[model samples]
Target chain A: MMTYAVECKNISKHFGKTTALSHINLNMEKDKIYGLLGRNGAGKSTLLNIVTAQTFPDDGEVKIFGESPYENGRALRNICIVKENGMFLKDVSVTGALDIASSFYNNWDKKLAERLLIEFQLDKRKTYRNLSLGMKSQLGIIVGLASRAPITIFDEPYIGLDAAGRQLFYDVLIEDYMENPRTIILSTHLIDEVSNLLEDVIILNKGEVMLEGNSEDIKNKAFYIRGTKDRVEKHISGKKVLSKEEFGNTMAVAIFDSISDNEIRAMELDDLAISSIPLQQLFIFLTGGKMIKRGDINE
Target chain B: MNRIKSHLKMHYLNSKKSFVIFWSIMFAISALGILISIYFKSRGYESVIITNSIVAVVIFGAVSGMVCYNETLPYMLNMGITRKDFIFGFAIYNILLSLIMSVIYTLLSIWEWLMYKLLGFNYEHFGQFFSGVKGIFEMTWICFLVTLCATVLFTLIASIYYKKGMMFLFGIGALIMLLMFIPGVTQAVFGFLESLVLSCAGGKGYIMMTLYSLAFFLLCYLIIYPLARTSQIKR
Candidate 1:
């Protein structure tokens, strides 16, 4: 029996007039790198916060290690959340932050921290305020990975890092996880960068779980079908059309259905443009490209 | 028990530097006061004794509140410590820090006594600063209570501000100021407190005030628990 690491049942939250999370139900298993992908205001942080007991949901319950996280210190002991903006104590040295983390988390790996310090090129003696934006983020990442908690969460962990630095983090994260199997919930906007590393992806759209499944399954779930407007419409008549656009007499339509390579090759002679939509492009089509106008619902 | 210990250790790590800074400043102030007393005695002026209990109380009181909001709450939570653990750990921190302060205050009084004995001259000192050799215990007791009272009260105030925002803080300040300006309110408040103090005067006073401080500490914790438990980290 594979035990779940995190389970949210009918969770919802609101801030005055704004709905932060609305009836979100999710279950995550142990030892997999889960990607929590969402556009801004898509309730990614709110869901992660509720899971870690950082914020209370307006409705429903959350369980970690098969126990409610509310006031459940034992359950939370195995969890770690690294926020986008550094939540480190102000004016404290890097070593001081690590010391405090080591004290709280029984499973803290000091050696990992020391190694990551070299990898990230962080100074232990420097105060948190003295670090550059990227350095501050690196410090947060070091703590998150080195804590060695069974359930580690990074809510947009790499906020301000160059390409090379981010690649270093992803490589370190995957290598570390491979050596030590644990549940990791990573939330980030740089979808395609970390997409391949994710085993499962959860997409949140306006405070609800829009799509979720095994990453490979989801990647093969959607494809683009292009041809004349009539041919494309005839081809996708029985399939779910996620979005469609027309350019002169030609049309490109996104279908939320898996198409086999044989069928795709079969349609090649039809003078149609056929290509699979990557996870990042599907994510944008599903959640992004919605610029709000004066009054109408923008999609 | 482990939760409390972890949280306490966590807070201790975060605040240890600040505590040392405050301690050094207090020691410098005490050293300066002692030097002035020695200089006055040499200049044919009356010898003086400047004890540190009052100064320690005032400084500790101011610091106790800022510690909670000074990135402590959010940092602790982000580190996976629960709110229950946080409050328990914070209480431990307050008791531990205040006890250390009280001991230092007592030691400063002892140092002053040694100075008086070495000089072989009676100093004109604020006699209440240290009651006597007996005052050492009393002074420690008083400092502990004052420290507890100040910390818990400030924590409560800070929690309120954290949850309620600047408008609420301004409203509270305005209401307090308004009440102060009203006739007889300030006198009534101070009179009540003074009477409470006098009622617990002598040996009875220290014990009673200590009990009161403990009661007030718990009260403050109870008042702030819900707010702290439900607080979310804001950007």
Candidate 2:
């Protein structure tokens, strides 16, 4: 039996009639990076919270390394979730927070934390409340990287980080992950930026799993076909069309299907354009297109 | 056990700065009181500086307990600490803090007594209010119990507030206000509280107070444990 680092089974959460998550099931394997992609209020944070036992699921269960994480220190010690806000107390200094984390995380890498502190240029003496938004994000990043927990999660860890800072984080993350492989889950809106870093992708759409598969496989299966309206419609007649957009005499339809090379060549010969959908575009087409007001847009 | 100890260490280190500030302000107050007493003595007037230092510690305990949930719970939960360990570690920290504060209060009381002897000024600590409690052990015991009870009670209140938010406090205030307007209810409530205090402080002396405070602490814990265990971490 293949062991999973984190298994969420039929998890559902409701907050005052708003369904945060609905019967969501996910299995994240060990030693792989996963991109938990979703639009706002798509329940990514809620799912992560339930997985980490920060909040209980209304139904179903979450298991970390085959053990229930809720109130189980043995199971919980193997996990670390760095949230976007309010992870550290306002009065706690950067060093104080790191010290607390080091004490709890048995495999904590102090030297890496110190090095990251310098790399991020965060003052050890600065209190959490006094840190800028970007600095606070850097602190969260340092903790997440240095904890070395078997299952490390970052929920919007680049909230206020600049482009250079985010690039640095990606570099450090990739370098460290290569040396010390663990299950890392990155939940963020910057899907394109982290798409390359993700081996597996889980896209949540309005409290449900819209898509889940290997990044390469998903991209390979999803395609955008652009041609005359009748031709595009005919091609996508029996396919799983995720989204459709009309531009005057042309129609573009995004579909998730496997096509043979001969079929693609035939479509290309007929003056039809076929292009592989980027992860971010695929994600938008899967989650964003449905919620948007199509009538408001000009063809 | 190691997790619990780690949580305890986190709580202690987080509160260390506050502890230092508290003691610094306390010593400053004591010094100012001594100066005023000496100046009064030199003018041939008898001025007594009655410092009920235990009150400050009790208040500190209450505030600390009330804020601990908000200040530390999210941070601990984010660090992947089990709720059980957090609560257990917090309970142990509370007990240890009460004991340490009691010891410090006892020492301060003795020091105040010596100052009184040297300066020929009357000094009365909070312990003198309880009749028949004469030794340092009794004083420390009472201090510990009172501080522990205050801490536990406030902790329960804070937990309730955390789970239910400001609405619970409003509901409580509204209930009290409604009860106060009812005929004979206010008197009945005050009468019960008065008797409860008197029975604890009356003929049985320190022993009764200790038992009463212990019972209160246990009751508070019984409520706090369930509330905290199931409590969700709020951002």
Report interface Cα RMSD per prediction: 1.6, 1.2
What is the per-residue lDDT of model 1 for residues B198-232, given as tens digits with 9 covering 90 to 100?
76676567778778888888888898888887887
Cα lDDT tens digits, model 2, A1-299, are: 87799999999999988999988888999999999999999999999999999999999999999999998888988998898884787777998889888988988999999999989889999988899999999999999999999999999998899999999999999999999999999999998899999999988878988778899988888899999998777677777777889999899888877778887887887788999999898888777657532222211
Cα lDDT tens digits, model 2, B1-235, are: 8788778878877888888898888878777877878888888887556865688989988888888867788778887887777788888988988888888878877877788789777767653546566788988888898888888888888888987888987898799999899999989999998887788664456787877888888888888889888889773
| lDDT (Cα, 0-100) at B91 in candidate 2 | 86
For each candidate, what's the DockQ? 0.66, 0.75
Question: What CAPRI class is candidate 2?
Answer: medium
Which structure among the candidates has the greatest lDDT?
A: 2
Question: Candidate 1 at residue B93, lDDT?
Answer: 79
Q: What is the C-alpha local distance difference test score of each model?
A: 0.80, 0.85
> Candidate 1: deviation at residue B78, Å?
2.1
Global CA lDDT computed for model 1: 0.80
What does DockQ come to for candidate 1?
0.66
Per-residue lDDT of model 1, residues A1-299, tens digit only: 65589999999999999998988888999899999998999899989888988888899999997899887878888899998888887778898888877877778899999999998889889988889899989998998999889999998888778898899899989999999999999999998998899999988888878888889887786789889887777677777667889999899998767677776776676777887788889888788755322112111
TM-score of 2: 0.92
Among all windows of 10 consecutive residues in model 2 chain A, the one with the lowest summed lDDT is: A290-299
Pairs of colliding residues, candidate 1: B200-B205
